[model samples]
Structure formats: C-alpha cells, structure tokens
Target: MREAFHEQLDGVFDDLAGICRSVETAVRLATQALLSGDAAIAEQVISADADIDKAKEKIEDTCFQLLSLQQPVAGDLRVVVSALRMVTELERMGDLSVHVAKIARLRVPDIAVPEEVRPTLARMGEVAEDMVCRVEQIITTKDVEAAIELGRADEIMDGLRRQSFAELFADEWAHGVEAAVDIALLGRYYERIADHAVSVANRVVYVVTGDFPVDV
Candidate 1:
C-alpha cells in the first residue's frame, strides 16, 4: 500500500513539472508575440492557457484524493500539502502569461511595447523564462537551496519593473497615456509571473525542509 501511495505522489510531482513547462512556453511565446506583433502567436498562447488551467484542476483533484485515501503523515504530508499550494502558484503564472498575450492581441498589427520601454520588457521576459525553467528543476529535484535562490531572481524582476516605470516618466517620453498604461501593466504582468515562480519554489522548499524561507 505504501508503495502505491508513493507512486501516486510521484505522479503528482510529474504533473506539476508538466504544468510548469506549459507555463514556461506560454510566457516565452507571449513575449515573442508582444514584441513582434504576431497576432496568431498571441492567439495561440491565449487558447492554450485553458489546458494549463485544466491540468491544475486535475492535479488538485489528485492531491485531495491522496489526502483522503492515503492519509500521508509527516514528510509525505508536507509533500502533498506543498503540492496543493504550488499548483495554485503555477496556475496564476499561466494566467499572467495569458494576460500578456491578450495585450499583444489587442494591439494586432502594432506592437504593444513602445520603443523606449522595449528593452526593459524584453529583459523581463528573458528573466521570467529563465526563472520558470529553474522552477521546473527545483520542482523535480526537490533542491531546497535552488528553490531558495529563486528569491534573488525575483529581485531582478522587481528592478526591471522599476526601470520600465522610469522610462514612462522620462522627459523624452512621447507615447501617450494609453501606451504608458500598457507598458506599466506589461511590466507588472512579468514581475508578478516571477513572483509566482518564487512562491512555487518556496513551496518546494517547504516540501523538502518543512519550513518556508523568512523572506517572500
């Protein structure tokens, strides 16, 4: 019975990693579409978000089933509990990517990112993709230290967001308020995606060490 339970637990972890990969693809493509003004790619990202959502629901159901049937204790209990929290964070990351893609879709032939703020958004996208890849590693390996180090990546994302804001307020800024608003929101979407990655990593730490980090 214990062997079967462990197998189910492993399946849960595998599903989480799969969802993380989907989110990684979503953010990367969303950034590409945003920068290149490719409405088709943006639409693809938007449509695929539903699969991420469905995967989250399936994982949640599996976690709950494990809790009720297996009654996992101690370390095993922590793994199940942390998986619940981690899935939530991953779902939100997928949603944020969808939000970025929708912004791209709205602009259609014209790119949503303005010239002055393009570099900042571009960097943010790169950082977000890298962080999600690391997240997948942390999830699969259960490396507490790698999970904790993700906080530093979140800090870099925060800095990029600030840089974007500065660009909007610069004296040479020529884009109107609407463009300014889009850039601000885009920066936030990327930053929040990073934040959620950190959250997921912290949950992995909790699964391995039974304690979350002091800093969020």
Candidate 2:
C-alpha cells in the first residue's frame, strides 16, 4: 500500500513538472510574440493556456484523491498539502503568460515592446524562464537549497522590472503614453510570473522542511 502511495506521489510530481514546462513555454512564446509582433505565436500562447489550466486541475484532483484515500501523514501529508497550493501558484503564473500574449495579440503586428526597452524585457523574460525551470527541478529533486536560491532569482526579476519602468518613464521617452502603459503592464506580468515561481519553490521547501521561508 505504501508503494502504491509513493507511486501516486510520483505521479503528482510529474503533473507539477508538466505544468511548469507548459508555463515556461507560454511565457517564452508570449515574450517572443510581443517582441517580434508574431500574432501567430500569441494565438498559440492564448490557446495553450487552457492546457495549463487543465494541468492544474489534474494535480488538484490527484492531491485530493491522495488525501482521501491514502490519508498521508507527517511529511507525506505536507507534500500533498503543498502540491495543492503550489498548483494554484502555477496556474496564476500560466494566466500571467496568457495576459502577456493577449497584449501582443491586441496590439497585432505593431509589437507591444518598444525598441528601447526590448533588451530589458528580453532579459526579464530570460530570468523568469530560468526561475520556472528551477521550479521543475525543485519538484523533481526536492532540493531545499535550490528552492531558497530561487528567491535570489526573483530579485533579478524585480530589478529588471524596475529597469523597464525607468526606461518607460525616461525624460527623453518617445514611445508615447499608450506604449508606455502597455510595456508597464508587460513588465508587471513578467514580475508576477517570477513571484509565482518563487512561491512554487517555497512550496517545495515547505514540503521537504515543513517550514516555508519567511520572505515568501
């Protein structure tokens, strides 16, 4: 029975990892579409978000089933509880990516990102992707230290967001108010994605160590 329970637990981990990968793809594609004005890629991201939602539902269902049937205790119970909350964060992260893509689609071929802030936005996306990838690793490996380090990665994302806003509000800014608003929202989406990634990593730490980091 314990073996079967462990198997179900492993399955839960797989589902979480799947959600992470889906979110990563969504964010990356959304960033690309926003930068390059690829409406097709934006459409793909908008459509793919449903799959991420479905993935979240799957994990939620599995976690509940495990709790009802197996009645996991101690560390095992913590794992299941953490999985339930972690999927919520992952789903929100997925939604943020969808928002990014929708902004791209709404603007169509004109591109939502201004030329001056492209590099900053690109770097922000890269950092988010890296942190999300770490989310997958933390799920699989249960490395508490990796989860802790993800906070540092989120700091990088926060810095990029500030930089993006500075560019938007620069004295010589020529993109105009509409573009500035668009990029500002885009920066927020990226920053929120990173925040969610950190949240997911903290869930992992909670599952392993049974104590969430104070900052999270």
Candidate 3:
C-alpha cells in the first residue's frame, strides 16, 4: 500500500511539471503573437488555456484522494498541501498568458506593442519564460536554494515592468491613450506571471523545509 501511494505521488509531480511546461510554451507563443501581430497564434494560446484549467482540476482531485485515503503526515503532508497551492499559482500563470494573448487578438493585424516598447516587453516575456522553466526544476528537485533564487529573477521582471511603464508615460510617447493602456496592461500581465512563478517556488521551499522562505 505504501509503495502504491508513493507511485501516485510521483505521478502527481509529473503531471504538475507537464502543466508548467505547457504554460511556458503558451507565454512564449503569446509573446510572439503580440510582437508579430499574429492573431492565429494568439488564438492558439487562448484555446490552450482550457487545457491548463483542466490539468489543474485533475491534480486537485488527485490531491483530495491522497488526503482522504493515504492520510499523509509531516513532510508528506507538506508536499501534498504545497502542491495544492502551487497548482493554483500555476493556473493563474497560465491565465496571465491567456490575457497576454487576448490583447494580441484584440489588436489583430496590428501589433499591440509600439516599436519603442517592444524590446522591453520582449525581455519581460523572456524572463517570464525562464522563471517558469526554473519553477519546473524546483518542483521536481525540491531545491530550496534554487527556489529562493527564483525570487531574484522576479526582481528583474519587476524592473522591466517599470521600464515599460516609463515608456508609456514618457512625454515623447506618440502612441495614443488606447495604445498606452494596452502597454500598461501587458506589462502588468507579465509582471504578475513572474510573481506567480515566485509564489510556486516559495511553496516548493515549504514542501521541502516545512517553512516558506522569509524573503522568497
């Protein structure tokens, strides 16, 4: 019975890692769609979001089953509870990617990001992608230190978000209010994605050490 329980737990982690990879792909493609004005790609990201939601639902049900049948305690309990929380953050990260894609779709045939701000937003996308990738590693390895470092990557995302806002508010801005709003919203979406990644990493720390890092 114990062996079977461990196998099920392993399966849960595998599914969570798979979901993270899917989200990473979604954000990367969403950025491409936003920059290249590819509404079709944006549509793909939007459609893929339903799968992310379904993945989260499936994992949550597994967790409930484990709690009810196995009655995990101590470190095992931490892992199960943390997974429940981590999946919530991962689902939100997926939603943020969908939000980015939706903006791309809304401005079909015309890029939502102005040329001057494209580089900043592009960097934001790269950071978000990298963070999610690291999140997968932390989840699988349960590296508490690596999880803490993920917080620093989130700081870079925050800086890039500020740069995006500065460009929007700059006096030289030629883009009208509508464009400005899109840029602002895009920056927030990317920043929130990074924030969710950090949240998941911190939860990983809690799973490993029984306490979340004070700083992460």
Stretches > 4 Å off in candidate 3:
none
Order the candidates by TM-score, highest first.
1, 3, 2
Ranked candidates, highest lDDT first: 1, 3, 2
lDDT of each: 0.93, 0.90, 0.92
Cα error, candidate 3, residue 82 (Å):
1.1
- TM-score of each candidate? 0.97, 0.96, 0.97
Which residue pairs clash within candidate 1? Answer: none
TM-score of 3: 0.97
* Deviation from native of the Cα of residue 171 in model 2, angstroms: 1.0
lDDT of 3 by residue, 153-193 (tens): 98899899888888988899998999999989998999999
Quick one: best lDDT, which candidate? 1
Query: What is the Å distance of residue 57 in model 2 from its true position?
Result: 1.5
lDDT of 2 by residue, 9-99 (tens): 9999988998999988988998899889999999999999889889888898889999999998989988888888889999999899999
Q: What is residue 52's positional error in candidate 2, in angstroms?
A: 1.2
**Per-residue lDDT tens digits of candidate 1, residues 1-216?**
899999999999999999999999999999999999999999999999999999999999999999999998989988898899889999999999999999999998899988768888999999999999999999999998898889999999999998888889989999899889999999989989998999899888887777889965
**Candidate 1 deviant stretches above 4 angstroms:** none
